[model samples]
Each structure stands twice: as structure tokens, then as C-alpha cells.
Target: GAGVSQSPSNKVTEKGKDVELRCDPISGHTALYWYRQSLGQGLEFLIYFQGNSAPDKSGLPSDRFSAERTGGSVSTLTIQRTQQEDSAVYLCASSLGTSGGQETQYFGPGTRLLVL
Candidate 1:
């Protein structure tokens, strides 16, 4: 019904801690994606889920990062043993479909994580 929503808009954790970021996509959207943006760097794709098909997890930087979408709606990104370098703004986006040309991904405000 509404745009994507992310909980705990900001987070601060000590190094070696684990964190879980949540995302809720718009109703009826079938494609969802997660990305990370460091202080001044471009958005780095983390994962993608489209309908009932397999999710694309190739963009995850390491084994510590993982995500899953449930019932084609809410999704969560988890980072285990977080390092300082893992600090960034985690973003979630969703689109109606991805089969056509120029599918625009509408992004949420994002959850800013800081690992001390």
C-alpha cells in the first residue's frame, strides 16, 4: 500500500556484534533488492529477490551478509560479526516487475549502521 519501510532507521554497534535490518516492500511489488552505501561511495548491490524465483546473492561482500524475503513481502538483511568496515546505509528497493526495459527501483530512506 505504501512505499518501502525500514525499521531502526539508525543503528550503532560495537565491532564483532551482529545486526539485523528489516524492510517492508510496497504491496503487490514482486521484485526487491538490498544495497549498501558507504560514506561517499556508490551503492553496492547486496541481494535481490524476484517473485518465486531464486534470489541473487552474488553481490554480498562476504559470508557474514545474508538476506531473505518472506511470502514475497517483508525482507531482512543480517550481518554477523560485524566489522567497522561494514558500517554503511543499507537500502531496500522494490519494483512491480523486472522483465521489461528500464524498471525503476524505488528506494527507502535506508538504515544507517555504524560499527564502533
Candidate 2:
């Protein structure tokens, strides 16, 4: 919990009601990513976990979204029944998931979901 840490940085519901953003990483990072930034557009790759494999949710954008990463750190992104374009700003990142290339991501301080 030194770099990637997010939780209720700001959240406002109303449309459908359903939110649970939360993330905690940076310790012995294995690889965790969930991004979404609307309003201005840029980063939107929500879902990815690498450790026990099987987690790249293919950038969830429907099905009301969903995410989970237990035992490998801590993560929980649920936005069921919510609408209003799912106002975004939810982001979380971690790295050190060595494989072949690319490995350097440490971000958090997002979770500004406002759907009113």
C-alpha cells in the first residue's frame, strides 16, 4: 500500500445505485490494472490481473462491469445497475509482472465515480 491505493476518493450515486470501487497494491506487485477515465477520455482498460492467471476481463464495458482480485492483493470494482454513462475516473495500476516486455505501472488515486 505504497503506490496503488484507491477507495472512495469520491463517489456519488443516484442513477441506478451500485458501486464498490476499491484497490490496494504496490507490495510485491504481480500485476493488477483497471482503468477508466471519462469526461475527457484517455484511459479505459478496465480489468486485468496477473498472478493465478485468468482475469483479463477484456476491458469490461458492459454487463454492468465487474472485477475482483482477492488473495493476490486486494481489488473490488463493481458497478452493477449503474448508469449515467458510468461517470468514470476509476483507475488502479501495478506492475512487476515480468514476462517478455513492458513492466512499469504504478497508479492510483482514482475512484471518482459520479452518476447522478
Candidate 3:
């Protein structure tokens, strides 16, 4: 795809289960980000990866959430021991590496996760 694409447009999982969501950024985009939007909430930043530099994980809501970008292209977000509060639409975004934290990002359609 020419834009960022996320796998498993929808997911339903039992509580305490683990789930993995995948994202593929546009070719050559060096910066990637993960965000989630819960009901009635705006996008919440989760993680960011830029090139081979250390990923910025400051936005993660809990220790159960983690993400990684490999080969500067694909990214995976894992949620362990999922809770009902973890249900949300996970969104991925990517941008050119030129502008540091100010670069414009293109977003994916998002993976809707439902924890029951």
C-alpha cells in the first residue's frame, strides 16, 4: 500500500489474553508512531520509532503495552494480559524523517480491538 496499513481491522479477545497488532508504513518513511482512541476520547499517543535510534515509549499507558519497529518499516504493538480498559482503536502513522518531531504524519485506518 502507498500509505500506512494496519492488519486485522477488528479484533475480539477475552480478558487476560494477549494480542498483537501490526502496521506497515509507507516505503522509506523513517518515523513511525502508534496511537489509540478509546470511546469518547481523542487519539492517545503510545510509541514512536525513528530510524535506528532508540524508540520513544513515553506515551505508553501501562507496562502491558509495548511496540517495536523493525527494518524501519513494519511495527507491532503487543498488549499483554488485556483488560477491558484496553479496548480501543489502534492507529499507526508514519512520516518522512526530515522534521524531527514536527514532521507531518499519515495515519492508517486503525485496528479496532474489543476486549471482553
Between 1 and 3, whose TM-score is larger?
Answer: 3
Cα-based TM-score, every candidate:
0.95, 0.33, 0.96
lDDT of every predicted structure (CA atoms): 0.93, 0.88, 0.94
Residue 7 lDDT in model 3? 95
Off by over 4 Å in 3: none
> Can you write out model 1's per-residue Cα lDDT over 59-98, one digit (the tens) per residue?
9999999998888899999999999999999999999875
lDDT of 2 by residue, 47-98 (tens): 8999778898988989889998999888899998899989879899888788
lDDT of 3 by residue, 1-116 (tens): 58899999999999999999999998989999999999999999999998999999999999999998778789999999999999999999999987986788999999999999
Ranking 1 against 2 by lDDT, winner: 1
Ranking by lDDT: 3, 1, 2
Highest-TM-score candidate: 3
* Stretches > 4 Å off in candidate 2: 1-14, 17-30, 34-48, 56-64, 67-78, 83-89, 99-105
Let me know the TM-score candidate 2 reaches against the reference structure: 0.33
After superposing all C-alphas onto the true structure, candidate 3 shows an RMSD in angstroms of 1.0
Q: What is the lDDT of residue 53 in candidate 3?
A: 93
RMSD of 1: 1.1
User: Between the candidate structures 2 and 3, which one is better when assessed by lDDT?
Assistant: 3
